[model samples]
Target chain A: MPLSTQSQAEEEQYVLVANLDNARNLSNILKAIGFKDHAIFTATPNGLKVTVEDSKCVQANAFIQADIFQKFTIKEDLVALQVNLTVLLDCLNIFGGSTVAGISTALRMCYRGYGYPLTLFLEEGGVVTVCKINTEEPEEPIDFDFCSSNVTNKVILQSESLKEAFSELDMTSEVLQITMSPSQPYFRLSTFGNSGSAHYDYSKDSDMMELFRCNETQTNRYKMSLLKPSTKALALSCKVSVRTDSRGFLSLQYLVRNDDGQICFVEFFCCPDVEVDEDL
Target chain B: MQCVVTGGNVKVLAKAVHSLSRIGDELYVEPQEDGLALRSVNSSRSAYACFLFAPLFFSRYSIDRGLDFRCKLAVKSVQTVFRSVATLEKTVEKCHVELDKAKDRLTFTLHCKHGLLKTHNLSYQDTESLQAVFDKDSCANVFRAQSRVLVETVVHFPPSVEEVTVAVSSERMWVRNHVEDEAERSKALLTELCLAADEFDHFAVGAPNSITFCLKELRGLLVFAESTGLPVSVYFHEPGSPVVFSVTDSVLEGNFVLATLSDDHNLQKSDSGGGHAEPPPPPPDDFMNDDIDSYLIAMDTSVVPGPSTAPPSAASRASPAADSRTRKHSEEEEEEERDGNEDPGRPPSKKFRSLFFGSVLPPSPQTSTQPVTTQEVLASDSEDEDE
Candidate 1:
């Protein structure tokens, strides 16, 4: 058989296969949600969803549509598996991962049914490397159930505005208190650190603010350590949507544009810290 | 104390700090009215680097009250603050360094052009100041070479070669890989390169000498020189002495000193051979043999403990007897003994005959003389049988 025909024959045995012209497209998006080593991958006919959780209080998910891949095939309705994201990244960038112009690593990922390892073939500049990473039983990710209908307060702003604030946030502060209200101090981010307390306030009518929907004033404090990883997603995003439910559950959705000018989304869900009574 | 460093000079300071951090975990910062000096010494004391930046290098230089203010800070902490020097150079307008004596912390405030301010407060430790003093005039050999040429030459050497021997004579300078073991030395291919004396801008040699030092540290210093685009000047007095590499730019000067391996004890001992009145050169035919004999003697006496464990060689069989006789000759009398062995057709030169004996014979004067005569007789008998 010819080379192409051989690979086509080999691809038939695998239950799922994904091919991308540039491996960095997948690697970069996976990095935005890579706060942990192991990532759960759930693939359906629609697309692929990768979820990573830490401390059971925070969860990050990256969604890559099936259409993003040049060649994506599935033998089953749904294929799920878990693998070490760090190892997968290393395999994807085996060719030194240089971002030089007109050079990229092409990737072909395959997975045979239950007990088989996930195989990756990366080729760059006429050189090829094949890596077989053992997969583990996938762990079911927790659902925050943060429905849009239950969102008490929501606001959409350009990521550039929030990026500045997040970069300058005092890391010494244990928790970051966010207050969204229709009254004065429309959107406020407060931190009490060792040096001093700092407050970054933005008016509702600011040019950076794209959308604002507030039914009631809600104040929630999330652990700074848990929210810190979202900054990675924020740095690559153009727009961000901030939402809080009545139970003080916070959700941040970031719209990221890749090198090809294609749109992707990375969302983060974080549970608020224990509320302290103020009427004492 | 407060001072501000602006413009492209901030990158120079950051690079200096990053380089110093590689030498030691803690950096000693000395602030004088003129400029600042940063110093670090490795744990093994084999390597030391010092960077001196003059006052003219900084845009705004000041001293609070004292003429000299010294403090020790963690290298990692300082490196973390200036991790993004490239970005800082473009956006940052000025960097203000303030020493808060009352608070026992040092604060670095970065003022950006867009009114963005970032502050970092680092804790320091109380440590004694480091002072490295070396006299360049006392060194016997000194040479100045272009950093690019030196770095390009050193890069060709194999990484497995740990120490490199640098031999400088009146005619030329040569660098070769230094092998420690005799057996391995013979098996391994030797890599040596020679450069004409004219290749160096300034070359001076009082005496012909060869010194072996760690190659890895020398490469590091050469890299620093290459980055700064400065000529590297090397100074060395003799074998086993520390070699100093110095580089100077318009704003800063750096000196790196590395210790050399000691290989001159046996050579010195042989030269001083037993208070002899006269030292005569050996005959031409025996010249190669004498060199091998002396090397074997030195290897036996200085490094090896016993002849039984010596490398399997024809000359090693006679080492035990030679070792005992050589022990009697003091350093002061070594020259006389070495000359006494050089007399043509002497019994001492017949030491090569003992290699035929498989067993260790008793040390007897007659037995020592018998082996040479028996070897001659055996040769004649073999000739007769052939006839």
Candidate 2:
């Protein structure tokens, strides 16, 4: 795999199209999903194009989405989650009528959101060092086998016995090292666990990871923030139970303490890898 | 005229003159040379199919309210007339007239070419008078009745839809005669119905029996299923019917869907689509009341079965066997009419006689036996003396 230079990263761009009434509505919706301060772009009659600094984009989007299921309206909760996932699936329905395009390109964007938080460093030979990503369930230590070259582009992890490790803040200070392809100076983080071992995967030549439908089901959860009403980081305390449905289906349920001492429940089942629209 | 193919039913030709009239307006009929041709202007192909198939394939459109009303009118008229004869028979028997061994003679004749609308004025007493007219037709010479009976009935539809009332009545009569037998009467009634159908093929009323509403909530949900990249279940049920349609996510529940019927609020009023007009006063009550009088007269005459009940000496001997069978059948019919009339002598007093036909003039109790008195008796003879 050859590394991408600063010049190469500058040239790459991605286009995003949404049916939102306006950019403000789009910003609000994205912000609810933990996105903030990202550049906002308006769609022209033609389309909207987005340019991003690889490291910054990967870092901002890389946050562990342990709670992605919260994005749906109660009435259309399941449908919303399913659509979000389907959009990520190599734009499955994207090029429905076109037969000429290879299915692989469509397959690549599926799990791209999983890899983020890549390490960034400049090199004189037009090469840059980008960080590797590790995805994991709170109960499982990062498994090295996930990054094996022989493994297929999509992988599913499961556990017979699973339990939540201590919260990330409660753990001893330590940094986990991940390896990228020797030729590429950068690697992207696919996904992360708020607590416990992280998982990593390597692509042959680019920072982009082949899209795959991935999910982690966590249970017995609680969230609390120590900061004041204006500024507070959400604190989650719950037992983690993880599993993935290969057919792009996910079922995750969480328990959190409310103002009352009683535990409240939240359930999530994601149908990821949804077919995307090609006319986007 | 050339025939135009509409769908499966071919339209033979476009009709120039619309003959059938309901109220003031002429009801348009498909020219008999061709079949009927009526279509909605604003609808698409699917809407057209829904309208066409509604009455035939689905039982939703089957009742035919108008025809049902017609049937009720026919049944009531015939039954009341039959009962009137039975009453007259008992009355004659009490009097011990002792005219013939067979029975007291009676005969009944109806001019039903006008169909159910002819009964718009008919009632028990009116029917009795009408029967006297028939009896005169049967034996005016032997009975010493010089005057012939005339029971003329006409069903008048209101000029405007707002006027719900109709008028009916009969003319002059003296004696009651022959009664129609039951099976024969029913067949006659059916024949009249056929005639009415002929009239109705051209009658086009503007209002629809029921309105349909479409479910718009299901629109975005169709695309939502595609997000899963898997099949989602769908359920659909139509209005006014119990049928349900369902499919998996791969197939759409209403894709090949026939759209729901569209309705116009303005359609409820008359086709003129103008604000409702002031209703006209109801048709003359004599129209329907007179018809009822004819029915009663018929019943009174038919109640007594005898040789005199035969059509006439010449015609009776010509068809003696048939006349005897008819007489025997009339006897059975009297029993049935009695059972039916037992429940509601109120049928004579129902508001529809006044509402749809005309305001039925309540018969003066004095005329119950005679049904109708001579106009000369009611008029002063002083004018004759002056002449």
Candidate 3:
């Protein structure tokens, strides 16, 4: 139709373009890391990374590889811009976000370099809506600098097992204490709530645990409020990788598979609430 | 009063309590030998819901020695305890409800399998009974339709629609969103649905009638009706009367009373005028077109138990043609005054006073001094003045 022809003619002026047959593929992942309003979008030839941070202590990143998109094109080496993630998601799913099979909203996202609004064209059935959301100067996202080599302890477990414990975690607790060791009490999640202290232990040899590598015992406490938003990613993921570095910086990596079975990754990095006394 | 409910019956009770909680914060529970009655009225007094569960619906029903056991409990407390009825249906063996009259608290004890018991004590307040008495024979129109059809049709209308106008005649019954904004009216695109007389289980119309009522409350009542998988019976006298929606199965009967909107005919008239020319003259004797004094009387008698004593004053005041004409003229003047105060392109101001009163004008003067019959003379007076 005329709309398709017009989009083709208008696509040449943009530095970056991405298209998805199902807009939910993008909206769902954005919702996973949607802990804050402003999201710093950094796009490269490899893929797209959306970063959201809270209080500079917790940072979340959602990675969508280039192959996941039906069509991904970039004329520049790097493109970065910041926009309201909530509004962007709302615009992406403007067609009521129906999950019925055989019905999907097609999306064509275009960004014209510097000072221009991030333009999105969403169409379902025959109706088309074009939304131009104003972009802001991208803020520098905090670098948690949590490297695998510096990781002192790591464990990968099935998301289903952790989901049960997360769902029942007492919110009255100020902090969630994680203890990983080579000896007994192998992996533990402890919460001291108003009612009482609760400990959820997972044996290192359990079927749900995929990998467990601990050289020495490590105990770290993370603010419950900071780690609460990661539950969204956990709920959508099939497996999760929990890692703690020497400095006690915690990282949670979730492997999420969308409706089409295409794989994506969402990572959350949270700073420890307190430095543990080694004597304990 | 003490009762035990189990299985699917508890789920139904929970749904009813949840629906009543939407109407009012406080729910009045009245237990009688026949059954139990749950009633609530909205704070605005614009909407009311009454649910009656027959004794057969409960597994074991008993009442303390008294005329009737009545108490008011906070709706939120009840709703929280019964939030997940589906879970209760599977896990709960039986639920026993007891009214501790001495302590002024109602206790609910739930017994589950494996000897698990949970009890919730809900404090209640001392409140007067809620009684809405309306003569069913006085209603001129009655129709019964499947709840599914009504709910599916209402879904087509936009969410902004506050009121819906239902027009029923011998031929067919149709509903249309009552849009009051001039700008929205200009679009000429409205959600309208019509159902043939055959679609209704029973359709009887003494006279062609049109009524307007709030759509939000109707939607809520329709949800309750659909949950029961029963047809809804609607009864109304005329335009400015309370529209009653009744749903009844073998075990339960629910009646939802919503006050029809006044001055809705004015909205239709102005809409048809296409925003050009002044509104057509108000219907001469439509009780709503009367002076504020008589209008208040008409409103008051519809709710309170004073229909016999209140109508004489309305009839006497409505007798003088000169006074009625002046009042009608002044009402029109006041409407224009309101119109002038609003933004030019805005639709006519809403009849907030009439809406707040929720008064239904008695259909005929023979029923209540035949107050409307005098409007014919008043119409002629205004026509002469116009010439």
Top model number, lDDT: 3
Please give, for residues B16-59, the per-residue lDDT of candidate 1 as tens digits.
77777766667777676657777765443345677888878777
RMSD, one per candidate, in order: 19.1, 32.7, 14.6
As a whole number from 0 to 100, the lDDT of residue A6 in candidate 1 is: 37
> Which should have the higher lDDT, number 1 or number 3?
3
Give me the displacement of residue B199 in model 3, in angstroms: 0.4
TM-score of 3: 0.49
Better of 1 and 3 by TM-score: 1
Q: DockQ numbers for every candidate? A: 0.08, 0.00, 0.02
> TM-score, chain A, per candidate?
0.96, 0.19, 0.97
User: What is the C-alpha lDDT profile of model 3 across A215-244, one tens digit per residue?
Assistant: 778899999999999999999999999999
DockQ-derived CAPRI band for the predicted complex in model 2:
incorrect
lDDT of 2 by residue, A73-151 (tens): 1211111001221122112223332323222111111111222221112122233223222322212111222222332
lDDT tens digits by residue: candidate 3, B1-387:
889988778878878888787676678787866789898765444567889999999999988754445666767777755755556677567878888777666877666443334455666654334544343445678989899888888898877787787877786877887766677686856777888899889999875656677777677677777777889999976654567888899989888877665444535643442222222243444345444332221222122221123332332222123543343333433442344235353223234222222222223223222223341221211111111
lDDT of each: 0.68, 0.19, 0.72
lDDT of 3 at A205: 80
Clashing pairs in 3: B365-B370
